[model samples]
Target: MNQIRPLIPLLVTAGILIGGNGLQGTFISLRALQEGFSPSVIGLVGTGYNLGFAIGCVYITRVIRSIGHIRAFSALAAIASAASISMVLLIDPFFWFLMRLIQGICFAGLFATVESWLNARVTNATRARTLSVYRFVDLGSVTLAQYLIPTVGIDGFQLFAIISMALTLSLVPISFADRSSPEPPDAVRFNVKTLWQISPLATVGCIVVGLTNSVFRSLGPVYAQGIGMSIAAIATFMSVGIFAGVVLQYPLGHYSDKLDRRKIILVATLGSLAAGVFIAFVAGDSTLLNYAGIFFFGAFAMPLYSLCSAHANDHAKEGQHALVSAGTLFFWSIGAVIGPLFASFMLDIFGPHALFIYMAAVLALFLAYTVQRMTVREGVPAEKRTMSFRNLLRTSTFFNKLATPPSEDKPENK
Candidate 1:
């Protein structure tokens, strides 16, 4: 526990920042719906944020290096707080999209700062413990913060004000926590072709996840509201789906280690496909069925990124996990930018049920690709695999570094 003592302030900052960010996302979607924006327009807003997030992933490291970590973090937090409250200033869809874009950039920088600092602080011995603690804080904060929407009610200034205040308060903990800044994060070399050559299944799987999961986070609330759910029920619906992913991540990752990781990816893809079908066709207007379907959907779908990361790591050369991670995230961001726009268009045309249909279609294609790959190539031998499975969140490249155990072989000192 002593090793984790210094990280408390960082963890606390994560909880605060994530809680506010989580709440603001759902709140914005619900508010947009209430204001009579079409599903397609609302989806465009999601796309804008994701696009900005992708931009940040590519460039934030440079900013951190240039200005230093603490200053970068404080600036990002302040801008995010400003963006959160700015939503009320104008009710335009385009305006909201712009604000979300700024928020995405700010948040990407903020997470990069915190995660890189944490990565710099830990040794290999304490890596797993720190990861577990950080994961718990991230998941717990996001899950509980869903209720903030219903608590403040999304129709007024209270929720936005709360989001702003939360972002502002996040500044307090980290500002005082460490007097000296940690080293800047390593810049990600985003060579998509190289990552594709390393592991195509993992590459495609990350994209599929981005295509599907971003829709759920960005538009799930809109779907719930369309189906006549109460505001509180909407919160429960989103929370239930997110929290359920924890139940299956570890077990599936453990089994993947024992066998070909692609086989595990196939299982998860099938499960996600099945759940999407159930939600789209069978659930209909039944609240109970919707909740149950999403519960299973989240259980299967949320772990795909982590599984793909593990599978890619199994094949990555020494010193290349960071590159693999950055490449996969780049692909995932591409999907995130496109998914909501496409899904929302379908929602407008065919109604909210189209959301799951789109997801199921994407998963079905990914499943077929997985099967084809397994046939074409042999699996990595169990003895040759290097990295163990660790749960991952799509935060930053530095987070991936911390999750990966250091390679065992010593340097030759060239």
Candidate 2:
């Protein structure tokens, strides 16, 4: 606790920032639906946000370098706050899409700034514990934010106001902190050939996870409403899934570390398939069953990215960790951009249950691919795998630098 005391302010800021952004996604989806936007249009709003996020990942480092972390963070947070409010005033699908894009870009910068700031404050000795705390705060705050949705009421301007207020509040803590800014992060790099050589299963796993997860995150509220769930129920449904992921990630990841990760991936996919079946076919009119199904679905699905990342790092030669991480993120973002748009089209034609059908089909395809890959290549011997499963959780673009080899930690590399 004492070791983390100095970092409390930054962590608080992170919770507030992420909570606001998390609420914004679900709120926008519900509000857009209320305003008579088609699922396809709403899906494009999601796609636009992800597209901006992907582009921001490539360029945000330079912005931080030029302006310094505090300024960059403050600027981005201000823009995000304004963007949240703008959605209420504009009320048009195109305008909302643009605002979502701006929100995405700002969030990418905000995440990069906060993570880089936190990275600078800890020594190698404290890095692991500090990051564990960081991850906990991140997941917990997001879950709490989902529950906050019902409190704000999805049908009015008050929710947008609340979102903007949270974003604004996030800027306050870091503004008063006494620490200096960290050096700018290294530029992101992606080479598909290198990633594929490292682990083909990991590469495909990332893309598939991106597809299914983005669809749920962006469109789940819409599905819930379409199927006659109350706003409060929608909140519970979303929060429960996220909370399940937090609870399940470490256990699933631990098992993957002990066994062939490809096998674990297959098991997780089967779990997802079962959850989809329950949600789509068996859980009719029982909210408890629906929540249980979604919870299990999130448990099995959310950890695949970390599992895939760890598997890839298992085969990564020295100094290739960061590159592999970036490449995985690149593929995931590509999938994110495409996932919502396609899922929205399905929803438009086939109704709410079509969302799960799409998810199940994807999981089946991933399951088959993993089985085939198991036959083609051998798992990394336990003794040969160097990266820790816990550390693999930090491979998201926000913490990409931490995944890099120690030799590359020099300032000159940045």
Clashes of each: 0, 0
How well is each residue in 1-414 modelled by candidate 2, as lDDT tens digits? 877777888889988987787788888898899899999999999998888787777778789889998999889989989998988887898888888888888888888788778766766666767777777887888888887777767777898999999999988888766566777766666688899888888898889987998899899998889889999999889888777776677787888888887777888899988998889888876788989999999888888788888888888887777777778887788888899999999999999989999999999998998899888888887776777564343223657554434444343243
TM-score of 2: 0.94
Candidate 1 structure quality by residue, lDDT tens digits, 238-306 = 999999889899999999999999999999999999999999999997899999999999999999999
Global Cα lDDT for candidate 1: 0.89
Top candidate (lDDT)? 1
Model 1's C-alpha root-mean-square deviation from the true structure amounts to 1.6
User: How accurate locally is residue 323 in candidate 1, as Cα lDDT from 0 to 100?
Assistant: 77
Instruction: Give the 10-residue window scoring lowest on summed lDDT in candidate 2.
Output: 403-412
Model 2 scores a C-alpha lDDT of 0.82
Task: Report lDDT (Cα) of residue 361, candidate 2.
Answer: 93
